[model samples]
Target: MSGPWTEWDHLLKVDPDKTLVDGETFEDVCQTGTDAIAVGGTTGMTEEKMATVVEACGKYDVDLYIEPSHSNAVVHDDSLDGYLIPIVFNAGDISWVTGAHKEWARLDDDIDWARTFTEGYIVLNPDSSVAEYTQADCDLDAEEVAAYAEVAEQMFGQDIVYIEYSGMLGDPEKVAAAQNELDDATLFYGGGIHDYDSAHQMAQDADVVVVGDLVHDEGVDAVRRTVEGAKDA
Candidate 1:
């Protein structure tokens, strides 16, 4: 059940809550070396705001995808390549795991299942927006993280296993543990990836490295370094 994401090794996740590259537009972000442009955010996500970013990225040749944080934030357009829906596997509240998904399915009848790819997430950033929103349990150790990864791929039939350390950098040991447990699922590591070294190291331990805040903070030249590190790692 690999989706469009399988073709991309490095994804530049543009948070709708944050501004684009200081002076550059979404088009510049796509052309700057990112394998794909993922439009999403944990808070303040709306279809109108997402559409602006999508329309900008659509101007480029890169693949465009949406990671909708809420059902109303989803946008339907020819520019969208697919949707990357994250199911918080370790969320303290059940809504993150299934309730929200049920709402999306019930509200949006036009959802193309073939274009939808679900990532089982273990959100480990206690202070991050997503963790707060979902009330995720961020206290797991390496063994627990590995177990979550196994359940995601084996029992849940997930295509990707995401270890989300949203506002902070992740531990290599934990990432390696999750990678070791997965036999075939793509491992995605995101959070605190701001430079080439971090991106390279994570890329070595995981299948993909998703960068978000970096593009918003340091701009595209810095982002290009990450793209190179992720692919050439």
Candidate 2:
């Protein structure tokens, strides 16, 4: 709860592999009053694609972050405020938890440790691309979700605990269970936040409500409403 993201109540996640709604530009998305913009995707991510989105987003006066899915897709730019590295606590494979991170750290000496922070993730959607790619266990109940949150903050010492449902809206009870366990770690909720009510519901328990497909599917105006919903919560 003590960094640039501490005050962020809303974030717009742009997938490099996907295009924005027709006639909508990065400028439009960035000006929607979201606390920040996070660039990332689960699949088909490449350095070229990442750079394209980052360059476009860097033009606006907003906090810009790269949520790198793989080492090769990472884009280093002066405009970037930080890197939000995901460590999936429920991934069946070790690679998504720490293996890839170790490899990235070993090969890259230019890493800015100060600007990089780890997000302990609990992927809770069995149908999502991230769960499929990482082989994450997504069948946990509310109590189990709370245990993971406790482990993320007390055991792993992660500053952020993300409940990622990805393509669908998550259960608010489960999100609240996780929130109850966290004393300091920022709780981030991202999934099917397509409108104001969905965003506000999740924002009630989450420290930050992140909207992804909303911008690409519904455009900037939809994202603007979500920003208001999250902040207003």
Candidate 3:
């Protein structure tokens, strides 16, 4: 389910030293325009680093969550908001999709999940890490994605259907097309959105525009601009 209308993916590029906000320094940074904070990335997301970042967001009192890289990367602890599991029937993979949820209750810690957001992830960027990691078949076809978007909400009851194109630039045309085809689900668009103009275009069609690397590179204040632009859009 969708937790809030607006959310922030406060993610960094795996390496801690390259991290924009350290584990203990995310409170004030997170308060600027953060309705919620989501942790996790495609790279060096060591469990320790994830814990550190989660704990840091916890310090800020913002809604803290993680988009785990894999099933085993989850921290069965109290510092997280919940998890967003990517489920793509096209890929024929279900581990990161529903498998993680099946065994969540049996973990060491009593995970306080706010909501489990089911997403039909669209991998548009060919050489993206997420594509490689998941071994997703990325053919960048509009009709292909439209069909998936059509079923994601009604069939799977997904909270969101994400039209994502990772790397430096996302495809707005594909995202817009998918947005038009979806049922009663919140459409989320991320990746390749580095500026307000691109973000606004994507935001125009989707329910939410998630710009993570923008904050990491441009700082919280700059991200705030994107957030403001998105809201105004």
Alpha-carbon local distance difference test for all models: 0.90, 0.94, 0.65
Off by over 4 Å in 3: 5-18, 21-24, 77-79, 92-114
Q: Which ten residues in a row have the lowest lDDT in candidate 1?
A: 1-10
The local lDDT score (0 to 100) that residue 106 gets in candidate 1 is 95
- Who is ahead in TM-score, 2 or 3? 2
Candidate 1 lDDT over residue span 137-191, tens digit each: 9999999999999999999999899999998999999999999999889999999
lDDT by residue for model 3 (103-182), tens: 65466264445555656787776687777766677785778787888888777777678766776566667777888887
Which stretches of model 2 miss by more than 4 angstroms?
A: none
Q: Write the per-residue lDDT of candidate 2 for residues 1-233, one digit (tens) a residue.
A: 48877899998999999998889888998999999999999999999999999999998999999999988888789999999999999999889999999988987888999899999999999999999999999999999999999999999999999999999999999999999999989999999999888999999999999999889899999998999899889
| Clash totals in order | 0, 0, 2
Q: How big is the positional error of residue 26 in model 2, measured in Å on the Cα after superposition?
A: 0.8
Sort by TM-score, best first.
2, 1, 3
lDDT of 2: 0.94
- Sort every candidate by lDDT, greatest first: 2, 1, 3
